[model samples]
Target: MAPVSDYVKIDKNPSLQVTADHRIEVVEAPIEKPGSGKVLVHIKTTGICGSDIHFWKSGNIGELKVLGNCILGHEAAGEVVEVGADVTKLKVGDRVAVEPQLPCGKCFLCMQGDYNLCQDVEFSSVYPYDGTMQRYKVHDERFLHKLPDSMTYAQGALVEPVSVAYHGVERSSVTLGKPAMVAGAGPIGLCTLALAKAMGATPLLITDISAKRLEFAKKFVPEVLTYQIDTTKTNQENAVAIRKIFGDSEYVQPPSVLECTGVESSINTAAYVVRRSGVLTVIGVGRGDINNFPFMHLSLAEIDVKFINRYHDSWPACINLIANKVINVDSLVTHRFPLEDADKAMATSSDPSNGNIKVVIED
Candidate 1:
């Protein structure tokens, strides 16, 4: 590898952006140097996430609207080529997985180690912060986790979503040998399935409306019971179908449910399917208000409904899982694109017919 450059050309930073009209554009901005407590990383690979597609297509995710041109990407891996003052844990040439959310360390939630719940968080790819779709990015050192030598750049980039999955599982308190179900077969849903299995969740079940996605899940985890949800059916009916698919037995109902789709119907189905006193972890980001929520059902069952913001203190566990082959993220990367073709990557990822489980952009 070449020596780290002491000074980089302060010229244009090639970036992928979503215009106000929701059009994908390749544009340029001025490069920035790492500030104190930060590191300048040469982003090697960035995974296109569902949230990115939401922003690219609608120019917003619920209330968080894109006021102007916004660069979109958060799951990224890179090489630390430059370190700023006071950065000690990492140095030049270190490979790292970039954790894109930067929370205020002084907040009450942050002090309690729930930084993801911080009131003032500057997350990448959000309204004010540019994401890692560019060639270079400056991030706080605390948010970057070193990748093991056995991990590829693509796998490193996947750590973000993996962490999200793991955090959901953790919050749900999934017990070993217990039944579990994931509500979607998207990247995060697949990740949740893999993690739940690794943690010893038996007879796993996953549901998705997309036949291609469900087929992909079957291939990913042959033992996982795959269900093709009927959208036309009411949520209560779908919930009944989920239970029936699990079979009629005392151990048939899942005690843990990870609702990864954020769709109202899926969430409602989850609300009904989860066993009494079950744990329901909502991992997907959806509209602020969901109509027809079966609050009475959830309350009557004494089910604990938990929501995860983003992951905090999860990178190390995610890295360990990937490095040890506990989770095979490498297989989830179905499409790869160069940084210049980021627009196409986003387009392909948005289309379920493309059969893209996960799309990555290489620098």
Candidate 2:
């Protein structure tokens, strides 16, 4: 194996606070050898997710804030560069997708095989942590998923979002012959549509404020209904538009709603349209505490509310689905940039007017 000096480190600049500039700097830090149960990775590709943009712009999200400079790219895939002395699962040059979030193995959630919900976790690209935008990263071997030849670096980078969709699918409980309506046509929402179809959804209808996103999603799932929900219109008028868009399926009653945008009105719409006993999956994070809801109607209608955190123990299944071509993961990536231009990529992802379906940073 080559010496660790052959690789470069992208660490946070301690001096620069929230006023950091656009192009992130790559400095040479100490090349600490993997202690144990760890493997160094040569990053190949990493996707710029929506959360990355939030951190870049506001330098904060909820509790996590950028008090210091941080490397920025998390939904990533790479090849094993070196292994820790005690590591045996992975070897040098093996392609892999990183889970990014390492839960404390001793946590109760980890013991239950639901590490996504573990209270004590070290997630990359968030506050107080460096991300995978660098030339190399030393991560725990347990969090690495070996990539098959059928899966490309970009597709592997998508595993993170796919895992989220997988978790949402599990939460929604939509079986075969059912229609799964995704309320937001962002990357995560479209990923949910892919997973829903893989999970046997007959017709997957998607809605978004932007017609471009809906049009992009239509490339894969033809049965998708892309309707512009006019917020200015009356509730009955908007519902009627959705009704007209998805005309004709007896199962397309808009009951099985997957709300990913976390917009208050979208949430209210989910609360209103879903039938009694139908499931409403909330996957996106709202701005602040939600004080208002159609609670009276929701109570009378008896809607099952579910909020998806990340994903748990679903990497293998998602990888297999991608490798087997069950879903066209490549179609989702509409933009790409080099790691050095991460700021532009992040900004492009932040602006919906750009019509970027998925933005990736290539090595």
Candidate 3:
């Protein structure tokens, strides 16, 4: 064998790792160096997503499981510390929001600008892929969107989820004067509601089972209407209540609905309320097989249902929206924690009883 010096171990950096179910700990990990077309970023803030909680609590999401310890964060913002060769767009000291996705550029989907759907894509915080919850990370330069000087690090981190919402709204085609409904007052739902409002969707409405969350959304966008769902009630009854928010007429159905809850009942209620020939975009990830999806109802109404995996080509618009103050995300961050307190942050976010809308970890 050659000299052992060739295998010298790199120094370690602080990183939060999920070792097993309901466990998270800060551990020292190797500091990865940036390679060609990559840049090393010092992570500043990371937002705890629902998917991250799923991994921390059960070590699995849907059919995917974390076979080993994985760093758990995808929504993040950071400053570039070092840039590798040929990285001309970015330099040291530049602040950016991590896109958290690496797609194979050669794929037909990528060429068609639908890179988020690329089958060979590698997403952060997913099984087997280390995420941005570390002190330092090496990422593709192309995936980092520069944060304007006016945007805060926390707002930069929010760009990821906002991007998801942006894509959903774009797909639903919510435009000026179009009535829109968002099913779920969660982070994604709130983001979708804000985007719909920015797109000039009038008489906007948001729904959730949690009164606290609904209240938060109402305050976040004071103009948008909020409704609390009663699980004990039938879908039709709940749909009627939702319609009543706009007016006392049956023709007040929204032309565009964004389902951000992924719950069976919420989706069915959306189907029940959306206008004929309307579009429904599914932004939340739910069960692999929904037993009663109201397929016949959707087919009969000719309501176009669209599903989004993640988001594609949405970072710039989100950044602009936040930077311009057109979409206010500053109020969406309800809880904040330091990097070392990641576990506590996760716990706070997971508890439905608490009023945590978005819990963020700052480095």
lDDT (10s digit) by residue, model 3, range 120-164: 888898867899888888899999999999999999999999998
Which ten contiguous residues of candidate 1 have the minimum total lDDT?
1-10
Please give, for residues 1-363, the per-residue lDDT of candidate 2 as tens digits. Answer: 433433544342211112244334444433445768898877788887777776767677677777777777678899886787778788877899999998988978899887888878889877666677766777899999999988899999999998888888888857788766788888889888887877777666777778777788788788776777787976556656676665654346655778888788877766655656678889887666675776777777777889988888888988998899888888889899876665566667778888888999887
lDDT value, candidate 1, whole model: 0.89
Return the TM-score for candidate 3, rounded to 2 decimals. 0.94
- Each prediction's total of clashing residue pairs, residues at least 3 apart in sequence or on different chains, is 0, 0, 0
TM-score of 2: 0.90
Candidate 3 lDDT for residue 116: 92
Best by lDDT: 1
Clash pairs, model 1 backbone: none
What C-alpha lDDT does candidate 3 achieve relative to the native structure? 0.87
Tens-digit per-residue lDDT, 221-244, candidate 1? 889998899989988898888898
Name model 3 segments beyond 4 Å from true.
Answer: 1-12, 20-22, 248-250
- lDDT for every model? 0.89, 0.76, 0.87
> Which has the better lDDT: candidate 1, or candidate 3?
1
**Best-performing candidate as measured by TM-score:** 1
